[model samples]
Target: MHDPLQYEGRKVVVTGTASGMGEATAQILVDLGAQVTALDIKETSVDVETALTIDLRDPASIDASVAQIEGPVDAVFSCAGLPGPPFGELDTMLVNFVGARHFIEALIPQIVEGGSVGCISSAGALGWQEQLPILMELFARETFEDQKAWLEANQETWGWSGYLWSKYAIDAWVGWRGADLIEKGIRLNCINPGPTDTAMMPAFHELAGKEVIDSAIGPIGRYSTAIEQAWPLVMLNSTRMSYVCGEVLWTDGGFIGANSTGKQGGFGEL
Candidate 1:
């Protein structure tokens, strides 16, 4: 087993630390002895060395919050995300994809050599590859404002496509930039979790339909608990996994397996 004290005195940052898996992740990091700089739009109940209130949808808020974090950060958890439509498809994409990308990019210079980054995607993002062209177009835009303008002009095409496309962009960005990040001795990876049990899950059920959430449970017949989702994310950046890099680990409780075995519906249905 890896030493429990491995993170003693290390500094880390975790976004969306107010609740759900983000809260669990932040708590776990603190228990592992890391001094955490937590960020969220609301106050996080978890104890951290520093906590900053920042709205992920607002690029300026993210910039201001990140500026307050003094680093040589050992790790970063990009765990903030919004569930699909009814939450405004445009805003979902902004927070889930664009904002996360901006935050990760800004932290590149502060990462200590050999540090790692882990982000939360979702098993619901299974269709990411099919939407590559759309994501790449938005990805090329230089500023958050530019991306927002594109969203406004092309809102019809997005419809309820925001959450799905946002996760896709995140997965794609990590895949494309993994090598570049590694060149700086920093590894970047993400997790694609299935229906996880969190406070935010109710929003998913409301937006995607309760049947969708019910059907999404894997062979395990249940959604993963918040801490269950938190472990792999934290482990990806831990010292014990020094060799792991640029990979997207699926934490779907065999849902991906069922889909692979033809037991699940088409990716479009998800």
Candidate 2:
């Protein structure tokens, strides 16, 4: 029999738990009997064992929050992120990419063998593989201060550049660091969610227009629900996905699959 309380007694850390996907994930973990330490810029109302206010843009805040959590961490859900544009490009990059990497690295010692780290990426990060070289350079930057300077110097003309590039760098970092993690018996993976209706959806529409958001759903025809995105994240964080490492699971309805395969009936298909 499958156990809903399979996670009983496990310890998990989840960021962005104030609302949306992170909130959903933290609640699910708590309900399943795990001790969840939730983090968000604002106070989280979710029913977690611990809630820590963390501004991911500030390394001091990140370190301070981590210092408060007691360990033997079984899983980590890197869900805090910024969508960019009106949200400051440099800050977006710092929060989404650098913050996640730093937190996971900090907790490496606390992660037990067979532990897992699941990152929330986006379908927009699909092109990351080809951009590995440059992304790696930024990922290697020693400090947020250093990266902030580089991000300020190379701001893109488009509004979503920070968001898109941050996700790209995150996806690339997964593959880059996967082997090292796996060697420690800790698996690293990420999920790429398509457009989903959340509080953040309105901001997306404001930045890209409603039509762009609507048309991006691919064959799915509708925005995914928060639970839909959260379930995959939970599975990845659990022992169920022990062998799954260095992978980017596109829970984007069918958007990523369609893009990869191309229009199926377009050329030479009977």
Model 1, residue 69: displacement in angstroms?
A: 0.7
Error of 2 at 168 (Å): 0.3
Provide the lowest-lDDT 10-residue window in model 2.
261-270
Candidate 1 residues lying further than 4 Å off, grouped into runs, are 1-5, 266-270
TM per prediction:
0.94, 0.93
| lDDT for each residue of candidate 1 in 1-270, tens digit (9 for 90 to 100) | 656537878899999899989999999999988999999988999989999998878989989988998988989999998887568888899899888888888888999988999999988778677877877788788688898888888777675578877888778878877878988899999999988888878888777677878777777878899999999898888866788888889898888888889887643355
Each candidate structure's count of clashing pairs? 0, 0
In model 1, the number of clashes is 0
Using TM-score as the measure, which candidate wins?
1
The local distance difference test score of model 2 is 0.83
lDDT of each: 0.85, 0.83
Candidates in order: C-alpha RMSD to true structure:
1.9, 3.4
